[model samples]
Target: MATTPAGRHIRNPQGTGGRLRADILAAAGRILESTGSDDAVTLRAIAREAGITAPAIYAHFADRDAIRRTVIEQTFTQLATVLTTAADTEHEPVARLHVVCHAYLDFAARRPHHYRLLFERHRAARGADAGPAAPDVGSIVGADAFGVLLQAADSCIRSGASTAVDPVASATRVWVGLHGQATLQASLPWFPWPPADRLATDVVRRMADLR
Candidate 1:
């Protein structure tokens, strides 16, 4: 087996390091989505999906948790992009807020497994210490999806479109409400849900006190 300049075993001497890493992450994502549980996202399963041996995963990820962390970060980064795009198109603060809310719901609906992995399963795994100050948010690192919502709420409050005095508090309330709606919709698709647009708009308006 050929080794890199640093003397580490090159799992696939024919494959570039970056490509192999991406393949491993993608494989792990598939397993997480299919199983809808973190427990199933094992190194062996990812290796099988990636057509590599289990030890090869270690070349890119230190352990299962590292892969899990990367997957969550990537998911949140994508979500942040979606939310940012949704807010950018609308000039009006209230309209932007509504668009962002709908975008979040849409993302959750489209990526139910990813959504569950990030919000549901991950939270449960944190046990009783997963409070507001939990490290999960900090662990996400670069992406700040919640910050996008906060900025919109802050703009609305400043523009008099919303009566909320505290942007952070208002945004947190809106986020909590949106999370509940999204999780419920994803978890209970068979249950009757009001039109998504209407429900999302109503929640945003009521929570943000949007005019």
Candidate 2:
């Protein structure tokens, strides 16, 4: 631990600040998942969960929103990694796209809270006038996650496997379909839904024009 000029002790010391920040984020994530609400991820709660004083958090994060934003960014990276790993399991463009779509749905089904947090927060941010905001494609987190679909669609087009001319447009449409399916399935688990793989295959074939 280190002491400031005023003799207040800082729990993280000098070189371990990054670790403390990560701990704070992990604590916040746990609170979010447990309570299923961002309101519960207050600084005091996170500090308590991390076994530190509330003042200690101020040294690492400006406030609760900073920590929450970092958590969301990390979550997006995790999603991108999942999609990339799924896509790597196949070589053919159409098959790769199908797997990636299924992977997207699987991620939602497995982590419903985190998935809901992503879009729910965006909708709250967008206000009613603009409608729900899709992930910001310009941000690094958004680009990394959505870029996987763009690459898969482009591959299909280049390989003569897809009839779509514009990869970006096709990818955007496919993403909308996947998002709709995932959200609906999660919110209405009792609904008679088609097989996930079949739904994903149909989406890829229709949205990307996969042959």
Candidate 3:
């Protein structure tokens, strides 16, 4: 692994071809998370962040968008892991849903940069292409992360903890609420927001109407 001047480690620095590619992606993720802006994710910035020459980045990524796409994918995968882990700890569907909701908020609060890049800035970068006609949650880039919530909502409905007639539609509503809260909280941290735990619970309870 190679350590950048910013003290972030890039794995597999001296390794073979695949390793270099992995390191490049990892480095780009670090830069994206640190900079918290799609505009800062240029190949040159990624190369500097990765502690390699600019040309080395080309070996793995075709352009800035290519690296951003990979980083977005990685971020979503990480989010899915976190949400799944949080939800798996409870047996009751209602409890699991609560945990999952809290986990989503926590992920955004803790990784504001990643959340911004994945949800906010990335969509803006896509411009008109990211309009209402975009693919459904199941086919989106971060579908797995949202899938955790969908599964939790389905389980809640099955267990009679939720009154929603359609699990997917209910899950979509809950997701919309969660995303709004997460985005607003991350964007306006200086505002005197309510207690996170209470707000998260309230959002989940109101959306699922858990019995």
Please, what is the whole-model Cα lDDT of each candidate in the order they appear? 0.81, 0.81, 0.80
The digit string of per-residue lDDT tens for model 2 on 53-111 reads 89888988887767766777777788899999999999999889888888988988887
Looking at model 2, the pairs that clash are: none
Note each model's CA RMSD in angstroms: 6.1, 6.3, 3.3
Task: Please give, for residues 45-136, the per-residue lDDT of candidate 3 as tens digits.
Answer: 77776667788777777777777777778888999999999988988899999999899888888888878778654564344467765566
Residue 10's lDDT in candidate 1: 41
What local lDDT score does residue 54 receive in model 3, on the 0 to 100 scale?
A: 83
At residue 29, give the lDDT of candidate 3. Answer: 72
What are the runs in model 2 whose C-alpha is more than 4 Å off? 1-15, 123-140
Per-residue lDDT of 89-163 in model 1, one digit per residue for the tens? 998988888888899889988888888778644543343454755554434343389888888999999999998
Model 2 gets an lDDT of 0.81
Model 1 clash count equals 0
